[model samples]
Every structure is written in structure tokens, then in C-alpha cells.
Target: MKNDFDWKPLALVPALAILVFPFINSGSTWLTLTVAGLAMGMIIFIIASGLTLVFGLMDVLNFGHGVFIALGAFVATSVLGAMGDWTGSDQLWRNMLAVLPAMFVAMLVAGAVGLAFERFIVRPVYGQHLKQILITMGGMIIGEEMIKVIWGPAQIPLPLPTAMRGSILIGEAAIEKYRVIAVVVGLLVFGLLAWTLGRTKIGLLIRAGVQDREMVESLGYRIRRLFVGVFVAGSALAGLGGVMWGLFQQNVIPQMGAQVNVLIFIVIIIGGLGSTGGALIGALLVGLMANYTGFLAPKAALFSNIALMVAILLWRPSGVDPVTSR
Candidate 1:
């Protein structure tokens, strides 16, 4: 009976509602929440994409992924600040161009960190779940403390370019340009990732590895290289996410990575650990839920994600596992 029903249309309902909700509740708060939710979901996608790949392909649970994000944000912020000082203007184009170098540097640093982690830390503990969890948690703590020490405890404001500081009128609703940029960037990244995974040789190898690591290894494939590659890619993605979040939130703090760690976990779990499509869908769902719930219960915004997590667990313990025949 379940096979007889179409799920594609059901999936579209959420997007449809997002478009129509503004008409129903055109309040500044609602509009803002909608935009914020969209922006947050995009950020989640950026981080979760790499995470899902690593977990799904390499079977590694990396708790320190949040650290990569925090590091990326800090590096980007520092670069932008320096650029602003040199250029003497916070113009949108200048800031945007400045972010390019920041992104590259952040990704390189994050990738190097991941490589070192895989070589020294994660290598010995491969397949040892308990040890992996313990070591990764310790790494997370170290990352958080390092940020506090280096950047201090205060929240550092990330300066947005003057042009991107305002909003645009969409019908009667005012939407922030930064939010628009976030959505556009998110879509482009997702699309590119989808294309690469679907069409590229390495992507095929990764998917094949996810299905059966032993089989791929037996075929003379260098599983270790693939694992390292996945880890580096994942870390780089997290770093990019941090940079984007810094721009969107306008603050960089030591504990910021810790704060978002749970949400990213929930997103991957809800979306299915190994599936990119699942991550994207889950992020959007969680994002919208958090935004809508915050409207009815501003104080309860913290619990919104938890509630969604519980619901997803109750409904599908395997998450959105695409291979599962439900």
C-alpha cells in the first residue's frame, strides 16, 4: 500500500508552504525568521555534506568537525578585517573578493588538519568505535579551548560589506541580501556536489566504498587514500560553513562550534548518515521547523531541533536511508 503512494509531491509541500507562508504572516519577525532559517539550513548543508560523505564512506564518526567550522570562521574573519584595513573600505565587492583568499586559506588549513588527524589520530582507531568517540570528543574540547585562548572569550564581530548590509523588497516583504547570497551559494555548492558525486570517478568510488569497503579494498583500490580524501574534503566543507556562518551571524566566538555541533549531528542523522540528498532535505526541514516554531514560542527555539530529532527517530530509526526498503 505504501508503494502505491507518491512521496515526491509530499516533499514539495514544505517548499510550497515556505513560499506561501509570507503571504499569511507578513510580519517582520516572520519574514526575518524565514530568511534566517533558510540561511541556517544552507550552512548546515555545507557542513553536513562532508560529514555524511566521511561517515557513509569511511564509517568514521568525527566529533571534531565543529572545530573545523570554528577555525574557518576565525580565519575568514581575520582575513577580512585585514583586507578592510588595507583597502580602507568595507565595500561589498571588496569584502566578497577578500573572502576568496580567506576561503582558500581556511580550506587548506582545515584539510591539513584533517590529514594530520587521519594519519596520527584516526588511523590507529579505525573500526574501534569507542576509542574513536573518545578521541574525537577530546579533540573537540581541545579545539574549543584553543579558540578561547587565541581569540579570547569575547564575541568578535565579522564586518559585512556596506552593500550587503541592507535588504531588498520582495513584493511587500523585505529580504536581506546576505540571506539571498547564502541561499544562492548553498544551491550552487549542493548542485556541484551532486554533479561530482553522480558523474565523477572518485565520487563513484566513494559511493561504492560506502556500499562495501571490503569489496572495494579487495578490488585493489587504495581504501586508505579514499578515506583520507573524504576526511579532508569533509573538513574543508565544515570550514567553509564556518566562514559563511560568520558572515551571516556577524560574530565569531570560541564556543560557537560547540553550540552548532548537536544541530549538525541531528541533521545528518535525520537525513541518513551516508546520503547527500538526505542531508539537504533534512537540513531544510529542520531549518523550516526551527524558524516556524520560534515564531510561536520564541523561548522554545532551543527545543525545536530536539523535538524534530525525536520525531524523525520515532518515524524512521534508520533516518532517510535511501537504500532501505521501507
Candidate 2:
């Protein structure tokens, strides 16, 4: 399948931003909200991208994807807490030194746990969608309980490092420094995934396997192992997202992953279940709609994404670009 970049759907992000701009009136406020929405969307994309990959490539329901997210957040909290001196430092580099490790450790730990999860909870239910759903959700509940056992049943504060705590003045707008970081990171992730999937041998194998498992397997490439690797990578991405999310909220809780699960699902569904580009587009839309509605009509904020999803599905039930094909 040659490259068929569905650029039309991407118009939605800028369109939404532009549509909301007039209502916001002030340029600075509009920019501020737009930046914030992008940041939020990036975080959501980080979380949803993994599940999208798994569902698209491995065909696993993975309802427990959120557990990996929560695990990553909690792990980051522990690592960051131990590095008080670095977090307390006002220097941006020093703060990043601390955060970089926290993010790394979070991803590593979460990915490791995901390996076990795939082995025990998910391996048995392969190709069984209903069983996959039931078992993976059970796995998440169990993982949550384990989190409570280790981290306690309370929310733990995840304070931003000193240099990243405040906002940078962008003209009349006050955009957060961390939010800027988030945007950059999100872009980097998207770029990396795009390059890997579009250019690399491994990515080629994964995509081929998705389209025809037997064809790839016949070529002496263990498709199952490739999928396992994909699942692990997805889990790591979720873990990375979890760290960003924890810092974004300045707190962590056992249920945080489960809480965000709905948003994640909405995102993957809105974007084709397997398309990385779609996930990015969907996440940005959801993020923009959320911030816009939250500010415009606070009471209606909760239903905004659901309404958005409904609207999107009404238009394209299979999602923006159902990558399940090519």
C-alpha cells in the first residue's frame, strides 16, 4: 500500500481552533487556550497511541491499557520524589535531568509489566474479542488493586520541577513552559512513530503483518514476536504518557488511568483504531473541543467529547481513516 496520507481530516484541528478563536475574542486568550488544548491533546495521544497500535496490529482489546498508564505515573512519582534536590533546583536543565529519568523509569517499568500482562492476561484470549475485553478489564482491576497495595489508596502529589512550574509569557498570552515541552515531546513521538512505520524494516513487517499475517509469517519473520514487540512498545508509550499526565495534573492516583480511559477510547475510535496519524488528529480535536467547551460552557464540558465522537461516528462509523486495511 503506497502512502495515502488522509490530509482532509487534519483540517479539523486548525478548523476547530479557528472556529473557537472568534468566540474567544482576545488573541492572547485564544492562543493560550489553543496551546493548552494542544498540550492536553498531546498527552491524550500519548496514552491512546499504544492501545491503537495494539488493537490495530495485534487485534487485542487491551482494556487494561490504562493500568500501564497508572503504573507509569506511580513509578515516576517515586523516582521524582527521590530526586528532591534536582526537582527543587530552579535551573531548567537540572529539573530536566530529574524528569528525564523519571520518564525513562516509568516507561521501562510499565513496559516490563506489560510484557507480563500480555503473557498471562492477554495471550490466552488472542482473537477472542469478548474474552479479551472481559479478561483485560479484570486485569486492570487487579492492577489497580495492586497499585493501592503499593502506593496506598490516596493521591500522591507530583509537583513540577522548579524551572517548569511556571508559565512563559508569550506576548499577552501566558503559555506554560511544561505545556510547551509536552507539545514538543508529542511531536517527537509522532515523528518517531511515523518514521518507524513508514521507513524501517520492523515497521514494514508490522504493517504487513496487520494486513496479512500468513504472508509475513511465511517470510520467516515470527509475526507473533513482532506483535509482542509492538505491544511492549505501545505499553512504553502509555507509560511515557502517564508521566506527562501526572506532571500535568501535579498528582497521581490509582484510578487516574481508569479515569482517563474513556478519553483514550474516544480518541482511538475517532481516529481509525490503528492509524497513528489519525490518533494525533483525533487527540488534537478532542483536546481543542474540551478546552473550548470547558471555558465556554463549563457545565457542558463533560459531554463535549462524547458529542464530538457521536458527530464523528455519524459521519464515518469506521473512523476517519480505518487503517485496518493498509
Candidate 3:
């Protein structure tokens, strides 16, 4: 990593935002869209961060990661469903009480499942990219079927808590309250990840393991265990992201995770194979592009992100900030 911060990639967010401002022509509407885009980006980052970590550190592409996402969403549905009183309340703090527990439980359940997934499904295919892809994909299918068995094959509503249902006016722009919360949660997750990867001893060991596993092991550290930990953490993050995504859509389907897999892959690829910072940039750009294009040309909304990825890859073949260690 460079000693000094690279501001160029950071600048792209604002630059893109500025470039689109003129086309929107309406300040208030533009503001609303920008915020919404940011919120969506953050939720995506939360989900993608785990996969990036797992790939960056373990070099294991667990295609079944989406299963964790779906699991998390379904778990949150049950948790929130049981807390009808709190969700039904108009008090923000009260809603948080219900939401926080749901998030926690979802993470816990996902992490446990991740542990087993690593033990049985992913461990054997370590370092075999082809097998990893094939097996993990099969795992995802099994997971989706399991979800259907448990939650049924129908779409279920996952509405926001009463206090989070409306928008807050800022000047002439209206920002959804849930979007604001999503942004805050995303920022917090980012900050924690940054601090852990940059400042902690465990982080040092993990990064070192990534660069030279043998060297790290020579020092008596168990890099394999650390790698497993990374996998579980990644799975847990996916779960958290699932919960956020489910709420964002206000509905959950058995195949939601697989459907989201496409965007998740796009975000990670654009961010570079395993780069955290790159993922954030890629996600925000995707979110913004999707929103801007959706508003201007609704039909293009589905393809905007694909176009953005191609543009990004064309400009920086390996992504904006690929982890060079790999």
C-alpha cells in the first residue's frame, strides 16, 4: 500500500455526480436521486465487502455467497415479523431496538452457516478456481431450495418500520429516512473495516498471510485458521447486506440472492478482484449510474451498470485499485 493516500479514485464520486447534475436540470430532484443512489451503493458495498475480503485474503471464490445474503434477509423477516409492536411503533428509537436485534441475529445465523459451508463445501476446493465456481454455484441452488422449503416460494413483504417509512425534507429535496439510515450504517461498516484492516494486529497478520502465506506460517501463525475466519466474516457481511437489501426492496423471494449475484459480481469486478476501496468506488458509481440512467432512460436502467463496468475496466483493466499482493 502507498504511504500517502491516493485522492484520484476518491475524486471520481464527486466528479461523476457533478457531471450528471446538469442533465437532471432540477436541483431538488437531482438531490433526491443522488442521496438514493448513495444509499443503494452503501447497501451494495456492505454486501460486496465480504466477498472482496474472502477473495482478497483466501483467494477462494465462493459463488454460493448469495445464499448467505438470502438467508440473512429471510432471517431478518422472521425477527422483524416477531417484533410487530416495535416495527409498528412510530418511534425511531423503538424501531431501532427491533431492527438492531434482527441484524444481530441474522449475522449470527449466517456466520454459523458460513462456518459449516467452509468446512464442507469450500475447504476441499481451495485454490481450485474452477471447482470453486462449480461447487459454490451448486451450493447456491441448494440454498435457494432450502429457503423455499422454509419460507415458501412466494415473495414476502419486508416493510420498513413505521418511523422509517417516510421521507425527510432537506431544502426542496426529500430524502427517505431509511436511505439515510442505510448510509450511516454503511459508513460505520466501512470505517470499522478500514480500521481493522489498517490498524489492528489481527489485520496485519491477515494482510501478511495474503502476501505470503508461507512466510506468515513460518512465524508460527495459523494462516489457514485466519483464512477460515475471513470466510465466516465475509458470509456474515453478506447476511447483513441481505437484510438491508430485503428492506430496501420491501420484499423477499427465495431467489433474491441469486438475482442479486449479478450486481454483486459487477461491483467486485469493477472494484478490482479483491480490493475493498475499489469495491466502494465501483458500488457508488454503479448506484449513481443506475439511478441517473433510470431517471433519464428507464429502459437503460438494467444495462447502465454493465456499461459502467465496461468503461471502468477499459480505463483500468485490473480495476481502479486492485490488490497488488495477489
Candidate 4:
């Protein structure tokens, strides 16, 4: 059981990367694009992980998750706007002081909204997925309007802090410092999730509830409460991802989250609905494929992930490692 987490699917990431390298030919260019892809994939994993737990444990299909992402990025704007001095500084430490607080505030606000969303929109159609999808989508539409009202419909520029503004050269390859940071953050998140879910009692209960909710309830543990907690945590992670994505793009718009929602869904489907490990693998593959395609054929960049998803689905329709099967 300890070794139940499969590592075989992860090989696709490196395999894909290696396969593309021969096409690119230039070592430095390949390295640069590969790192960029990995960075993007890690950011996606951060956002998708929460949904994985929510769906895996609660069977809740929340289409409004994008709202939380937009909220988090907007919240970061306010927090960072107030700390202009820190973000404007050349010192990395000062920038972190501003960013760390913004991240906290974004997570807090997103998590709070998640609670209300659970109470109102999601709670009613607990088992009706069709209603859940329709209502949650409506929730997203309204949330976008609300965001436009608060932040204005115009795209707000979210500049990188001075400390992370440029790239470092590594043997003719330029790697952005922020991208490396994203990779570290993603690894940390994955490690934390693996530890919490695989090594802790609470994690045990969560898994137990997922497998059989009634049994856990009969044992005096409240499954509803756990589900709520999962939703909040998932929302918080989406918020965290929002902040990262905003910084990555150096701009924020009300629809930014919705635009990303497509990719998130692709990752979920590719990863087999509720599997975290599968999500990571799928995300990395997507990121790599997008970059490779963009460089090799710019026109195909927009549909690269979609194409990858379809290919993956055709090969393994249930996903690379479907949680339902496990």
C-alpha cells in the first residue's frame, strides 16, 4: 500500500521532453523552452490539486472555481498596491515581504468565498451534477460581472517585482528567476499534499470517506464537514494559482480565470478526474507540449493542450491513472 502511488505515468514528462529535443536541435533553446514549460505546468498543478481533492472526496463539480482565481489575483492587486515600496525595491527580500502577505490575503479571501459558495450554490444540488454544472456556471458569470464592477473591465497590469524582473543565463539559456521559484513552489505543494493525504490520520479519514462515506459517518466522523474543508482548501489553492498566473502574464483580467479553466479541466480529465499525481503528470505534459508546439508551429499553440488531451484520451480513455479505478 505504501508503494501504491504509481510513478510510471510520470515518465511521459521526460519522454516527451526528450522526443522534442531532437526536433529543436539546439541545446540552449531546448533547455530554455523546457524550463518554461515545466514552470507553466507547475502553476497549473497548483490550481488543479484542490479540485482533485474536492472531486475525489465530495463528488462536487464546481464550475465556479474560476471566480476564486479571479478574486485571489484581484485581492493580490490591492495588497501589493498598498505595498508599492516593497515591490518597487531591488531587494528580493523586500519583494517577498510584499508578496508573502498578498498571497496570504488572497488565500484568505478566496477560502472565505468558498465557504459561502458551498453554503449557497453548491449545497443545494448536492447530488445533481447537471444542476450543479448549470448553477455553478451561472455563479461564474455573475462572479465575473462582480469582478468587473470592483476591478473595472480593463486589464490591470501586474508587474513582476524588481527582484524577479529579469532572467539568469545558464550556458546560453536564459531562465527567469520567477519560473524557477514556481517550480520550487509546485514541488513543495505536491510534497505537502502527498504527506498530508498519505501520512496523516485526517488524510486517512478523507480517503476512507471517499471510498465509503456512510462507514466514516457511522464511526462518528462528519463527512460533510470534511467535504467543506476540502472545497475551501481547493479554493485557496486556486487563489494561490491566480496570483502566480497573474504575475506570469504581468496582467490580470476578469476572464483570466475562465480562460485558465479550460486548461484545468483538460488536466483533470487527462489525470483521470480526481488523481493528484495524474494531474501533475498531465500538467507537465501539457506545458511541454504547448511550448514545443509554439516553437515548432506557433499556430498550433492554442490547441496544443487540447490535442494532447485527445491523444491521451484515445490511448487511455479513463485517464493515465484514474482514481475511480484505484
Off by over 4 Å in 4: 1-4
Instruction: Put down candidate 4 lDDT per residue, 212-303, tens digits, no spaces.
Output: 78889999998999999989999999999999988888889999888999888999899987788888998898888888998999998868
User: What local distance difference test score does each model get?
Assistant: 0.78, 0.90, 0.88, 0.89
* lDDT per residue (tens digit) for residues 191-277 in model 3: 888778778888777766656678889999988899889888988999999999999999999899998888889999988876777
Best by lDDT: 2
In order of appearance, the predictions have TM-scores of 0.90, 0.97, 0.96, 0.96
Q: List where candidate 2 sits over 4 angstroms from the true fold.
A: 324-326
> Mind giving the per-residue lDDT tens digits that candidate 1 earns over 1-326?
01122244237326634664764455665667677778778888898899888888878888878888898888887787778743344576666677778888888887887788778778888888889888987887888788788777788998676667778886667888888899888989888887777678887788778777899999999988998998999999988999888888888987778778888999889877787777887777777777777676778876877887777778878675442432
Which 10 consecutive residues of model 2 have the lowest summed lDDT? 1-10
Write down the TM-score for model 3: 0.96
lDDT, candidate 3, equals 0.88
Candidates 1 and 2 compared by lDDT, better number: 2
Better of 1 and 3 by TM-score: 3
